[model samples]
Target chain A: MDTRPDSGHVLSADRPGRFGPYGGRYVPEALIAALDELDREYAAAKQDPAFTAELDHLLTTYTGRPTPITEAARFGAEAAGGARVLLKREDLNHTGSHKINNVLGQALLTKRIGKPRVIAETGAGQHGVATATAAALMGLECVIYMGEEDTRRQALNVARMRLLGATVVPVTTGSRTLKDAINEALRDWVTNVATTNYVFGTVAGPHPFPTLVRDLQRIIGVEARQQVLDLTGKLPDAVAACVGGGSNAIGIFHAFIDDPEVALYGFEAGGDGVATGRHAATITAGSPGVLHGARSYLLQDEMGQTIESHSISAGLDYPGVGPEHAWLKDSGRATYEPVDDADAMEAFRLLCRTEGIIPAIESSHALAGARRLGERLGPEATILVNLSGRGDKDVDTAATWFGLMDDSESEGGR
Target chain B: MTTSVAFEKARAEGRAALVGYLPAGYPSVDGSIEAIRAMVEAGVDVVEVGLPYSDPLIDGPVIQTAVDAALRAGTTTKDVLRVVEAVAATGAPAVVMSYWNPLDRYGAAAFARDLAAAGGSGVITPDLTPDADDTWIPAAREHGLDTVFLVAPSSTEERIAMTTAACRGFVYATSVMGVTGTREQVGDAAAGLVARTKATTQLPVAVGLGVSNAAQAAEIAAYADGVVVGSAFVRRLLEAPDPAAGVTAVAELAADLAGGVRTR
Candidate 1:
């Protein structure tokens, strides 16, 4: 009966069903049995020392944890107005993003739960690529749904996922994008309820998902918080991260939510501009509604139907925010702002030029927000920006956007 | 009399009926009301007033957009119920088609009583089953409203029998394997499903999903007692932009489909 001796590390015995004000089982009746099974398995796995040791080995050898908290001295000097800037350097993580942390944990959990097939929905394809990588390493059958448009734009990532032995399904419904991919994935899950474990990529979805992903990803904040404090002698004036379903933001901000001295800001993508009816600023312009299995801030019509959302960054190009992020916005625990495509692109280029760090276009939204906050805080404020991912994956898009590639030439090759 | 008694009579008389669907206040609340009025005037046997939720998983693009417009227009469950009451005042048979959460939130039993009192004849929770039927069905029957059940082509023989036994007004047979509002033609597959459902139950089996036009409706009516066309009507409403005109247009279409029914 006591099968889960390995789960002691992740879930605290004191608070077995909570993650701050977030996380709980808020799904439908049909998923109750599967969720209960998962909860039990997860509990047992945390208590298993062997499971912990193996996971630790993967974190060290595979994911490259204790990722450097590098001082972006030159970039910081300019951004600080005199204050220092510290990068959590999650960009250095394998697969070049913090997305791997959650993917690896879930892949391990998938095996523990005895599920042979893993499914995920991808927008920017970072999470898809990460999930595909984990599945190939563990040899689980993997299926990833990407928007048809994203499949084309992020072709290399599609190839990457295929190379990792995952089936890449191009979702061609609704907007033929991320939201539709989510719809298709949910339908797949409902159909394959008995045989599959959906490796949800971010801190979103119904109940346990937002909690599960945060717990898996908390390592980033746990390490970064300590690393930053040790290096700076105090908490930074502000913490900034981009909001694509708010995973990385929550990962970093959860540790500092109770820190009264630190201000947390989440940057949303304002595509062309908020007024142009094009943007993914759900927290800023949306209301609470059920989407992708959870009640969250969603861009929707009054009848509760999902509305078309736009964002220059493909990862942030979704119509709904994670449920906890909605709660945070409603409760005023965090402030969210929209950074337009132009500003984010400028910041993307600026960071590359000044710090030699090419961040994902999604991460550049955070950098754009940091620049504004830096101006407001004025020379006396230190900001810890979560350089959440590297930009190699986005190079082709960046090249075209910046006109670095010839208009007539096909520019996908590395 | 119970709504189920009416369905039994309809089935016995060998007279297939029509059930029209419209989002509450789609073009506008008034437009939706006019559509219902037209449906009643146009001889619709039943009207399914949809309580729009944000994400309708089983719906195609057209109905989804209609729902979006309705929600944008500030339509709520309470507002939809008011629309139901308004339609009921016209003496048209009304059924509320909705997801379970809103019904659960409103207290299923309480909702049943209020809806029955307000002139609604039936309740169709699209996602519920007989085993899980206790959540709303008993309360609905207690309040004198019929609790309809749905069966798809994928339903097992055992499931069809179970659903037929538990069903009240009529059994709704989803003709296709996909969502509502799809333009995929309703083929012989739907006809086959209707025949199968008929074998399982003495109750009238109404075919929905992919029954977009009068031709499809006539085709479906050949096998089933009735055909449910949601997206086609919603599409008309979407195009006309005026709710009354949209309803009249759909009512005309419904009449055309009803005219095509041929009994053996």
Candidate 2:
């Protein structure tokens, strides 16, 4: 029977891992037992003080959690309608991104499941690098799947993952990008489930993943909330983050779902523009369909073939969005908008010049959206943006875009 | 005329039914039809016309390569139905095995109606589960088409029972814990999974995935009601020098598999 809409499945009630009509196990039956075991493990992990203490110790000593919030005064006054913009400095964390938050949790869960190896699929390789790092830390065997095209485009991250002692398999099937990488990773998981854990990187996959990753990454908002209060004496008027598969956005937004006054804005990658039909603006331009694992908004053709998504930011170039964002958008708890490649680059350059903080291009979408939201909410509003990662991984793309790198350097002929 | 009729006739002969799968428009829409026709003529009891999808996560490299070729050749939902129509014209029970999206995109009710009108028997969803589904069951039910759901080796007793209850034509036991590919040996878990599935429902239980040879087919047929072979047939076409050769190769393989089922 079709039940009524899920009333905030995560914090409100113990849902069957559903967010309204979105998010369910739309996977093959083979993984159901594993998913159930993961669900049970995560639930128990949440209650067990030993697990929590160990995770907390890792977060503090190893991951350097409870990251600080910096006020972007110069960038705010110049670009954002003079609104107070506060940046949640997830960039400064050990792996240089908020991805470490969830990766560490799943790596721990992988160990708890008694599986000694982990496999992960990556788009731009942020999650892949993070997963590789955690696997190395835990002394577990790790394998990373990246699309062939992406492996060439993101060679440095490939190097990083390799340096961390993970095998990098270049997937040649399908579009040979993030989508195909995920497909290959799922195939690997199905074959090696008895010994390996598919360390899902985002909140977009089936069942417990959307819920599980969110629960692990929610510390972004959980910590941001208290940190913002301790600094500002009151909650911010709004929260903003970039949405690809929407792990970081969902991570930052979960703690704010109950705060009705705080408007949540997710910035989708508008490659050229949504109107031009070349963008990854799933929530803005997509119809609800199944992709990856969960039923969510996706770029699909009339016959349901997944249309390739485009974005200058490789991390944000995904056809399907997290199911929670779909639910949040439909339920009117959040608003999603597209930021064109040019606008995001403009913001990317602006943040580096004004705040001396180079943000991930994926996070640049959120920064660009905040400027728009600041204009809408006016100067009186306080906006907290989750700078999900540092820009070190994105320097090459940024250098080429801004013409900072000459042709010879980019071409590698010199 | 239907899966039940075909399967029952095979059962009456004291042999497990041979099920063959070939994706629509693999070489071309017409060439795909020819391959399945060869399969049926060579003694494949049931024809499973695969509807190629953009994201085929349940498939291995062999099927994925074939599906990609089909998509590149402009295989559409309509072409898949056309293939089904051609296979059914042979008086063989034909079913379209597809992922959920294309059918969902074509409108589940509409696709079901189109398939029924096409003289098709049912759909076999590799991804969609009975519990996860909302629209497909009703649409298939309305069109008098069977909804075949898979029961994996890792499926719990509760899930197996629920999956079988929601299934109509026959249950697809995924035999292995992984996607579609021919393994060196059939997983030992297949027989136990089939026996467990049989205890729950009277519907014939067909074993799919990793069955590459007649020996493997015979092994599965010893316990299963039907032996489903896909990648092996697709691999022949993938490696064929010519379309006609692919059809002949598929026919040869199908005949060999058919023999294996009977001997068992």
Give the interface RMSD of each candidate: 5.9, 0.8
Cand. 2 TM to true fold: 0.96
Highest TM-score, which number?
2
- Regions of candidate 2 where Cα sits further than 4 Å from its true position: A1-15, A407-414
Report per-candidate DockQ. 0.13, 0.86
- Candidate 1 chain B: worst 10 consecutive residues by lDDT? B1-10
Model 2 chain A is weakest, by summed lDDT over 10 consecutive residues, at A1-10
- What is the CAPRI rating of model 1's predicted complex? incorrect
Name the 10 consecutive residues with the lowest summed lDDT in model 2 chain B.
Answer: B126-135
> Model 1, which residues run further than 4 Å from truth?
A1-29, A406-414, B1-54, B59-92, B99-264
Please state the error at residue A183 of candidate 2 in Å.
0.8
What does fnat come to for each candidate? 0.08, 0.84
